[model samples]
Target: MGKALIEKGQIYRNEEAWELFSNLITEITPSKVFVIADENTNKHCLPYFLKKINFEKSPEIITIPAGEIEKNISTCLKVWEILSDKGADRTSLIINLGGGVVTDLGGFVASTFKRGLRFINVPTSLLAMVDASVGGKNGVDLGHIKNQIGVINLPEMVILDTAFLETLPSEHITSGLAEMLKHGIIQSEAYWKRIKNINRENKVELNTLIWDSIEIKKAIVAKDPFEKNLRKTLNYGHTLGHAIESYFLENPNKKTLLHGESVAAGIILATYISKDLYGFPENKLQDISESMFKHFPKQTFSKKDIEAIINLLIFDKKNRNGKVLFVLLEDIGRHKTDCVVSNKLIFRAFEYYKNF
Candidate 1:
């Protein structure tokens, strides 16, 4: 309860989220309440959500197949159909109860359904709670490309409950930490040092850390909602990171990397590039690299794998004028955006990551 209601959205921690949500929803009193979920949260999270809220009418529940592969136009059409069949209208309130995929796709459907329905986001996973839920960004992937099709729209309110994290997988927790680290890398050196102390002080509850991470992101998005300039700092690792994420997702032979896992690797490569291009301190790079490697095991990538990943960078959402624009760090807490990089440098960075 340190800082609730960031800008427009409401962020509650732990059990208090339920009462706040119940009160807020009861006040709005929508014509209908529709809850959306993926397979995982449907079975795991829905019961808790239903048990907490005292509704005038039981909300209709819609479940979709989970995972990134299910994020597409086809899946969206299915959600759209359910809303249409259920007579969801502008007065309807859609509650998205799940991780990034569920919240992302759910927001897209609700925003477009009848020219927008008021919706609430309840992010279950750490990724969603810290990064995905705070931002107004919502979209499904176009083919294997990540977030290529999405509109910018804030939810009526966002519900944050760490209780939902009890059922979350450990790997998903690690995945979200990558985003948390990015916040420090781009915003505050003091924040980065605190997170790096994870090795020494491992006893801290993730909920506290998560609150700080959300605050970091909220500070930036509050200034540049459209990602015009200041907000691009949020993409510190996402340019090549998205390319790596998309590459692994499309290749059957390669093990699929979680968004944050690929992002962890991308941050390493980008930091190396930053050192070469912007004089970022080598000691800082080493500490960041070691911390990331401690949590994420290195994936041995082939020469072809590197090339394929590099090629995918051209399709990055942050690209401009057919050039791959990078968000490089001049130092911790200092970022340089719109920087262009060459294939040769990317290859060298892969070599650095390999030997790192």
Candidate 2:
């Protein structure tokens, strides 16, 4: 039996995952089924997925362009049109088989189309497996901003298969590690230590860490499903991270960064801020910065670039009463939410990042 992550959804893993998924299809007996994948997963993951389960009828394949840039209202409109034309109703089921972009956009489309269609998230990337797919927070970017238009609707189930990670690039694997690292920083020091020493070549260890990361997220979401308090801690690195990601994404001159790469940078900056404001201990701060830099190469930002990134912070979803709020740390596993930081201090943090 699959373990329930929330009241509405359960997580199925590895050998048991396929058997449970097959059972689910029989139980739902949806009017029609749709499989949504980006170009990459369509080529790499869909074939394996199709072979594992037998659908009553052939699933309609909806392929979207791959990459973060393709996650938007325009893409959502295209998916919605496809769903409408293909006769997807409330009784239909959608299997989102890809990374965060596909899972997020597909979930949103399923939630909105015909006032909600049953959906399952088959997260193929490391980023999706541990974070995006597990959370039930689904949405797409608005312009250059991250996750601006979205919903907090749970999927019917989440199928996590580590086999799909073999299809990802090493950099992408590193990208996923950032969130796992964040899980450690905000939740457990032992987890942080274990994650910091991860040897990617060790498959058994890697899979165990992945499950552990999911449990950490599950515990947090269970307590604060609406992000009223404890759940806000999950955004520790994302506040500044999203801004940095948006800036690079919108700038033609700079190389666009993977979501985790930017978050790694955000974690470092936030740690510096935490140390300065709440006495979060400089030694741990140094440790975090060093570990992050080890996995993610430093991204250079000119003064003008930094300014634009700072400007994008105003659009962050965590803002309250027109004020930008952040989730900062007092120590490992100790966090404070909705804190304010001055521009001068932010600038100083950037200087620290640049110099380090």
Pairs of residues at least 3 apart in sequence or in different chains that clash in candidate 2 = none
**Candidate 1 worst ten-residue window by lDDT:** 1-10
TM-score, one value per model: 0.95, 0.98
Worst 10 residues of 2 by lDDT: 1-10
Q: What is the lDDT for 257 in model 2?
A: 95
Model 2 TM-score?
0.98
Residue 53's lDDT within candidate 1 is: 86
Q: What CA RMSD would you report for each candidate? A: 2.3, 1.5
Report the Cα lDDT for candidate 1: 0.87
lDDT of 1 by residue, 144-188 (tens): 989999899998778887878888888998898899989888978
Q: Which ranges in model 2 have alpha carbons more than 4 Å from their true place?
A: 1-7
lDDT for each residue of candidate 2 in 294-319, tens digit (9 for 90 to 100)? 99999998888878888899998889
- Model 1: what TM-score? 0.95
- Alpha carbon lDDT of residue 141, candidate 1? 92
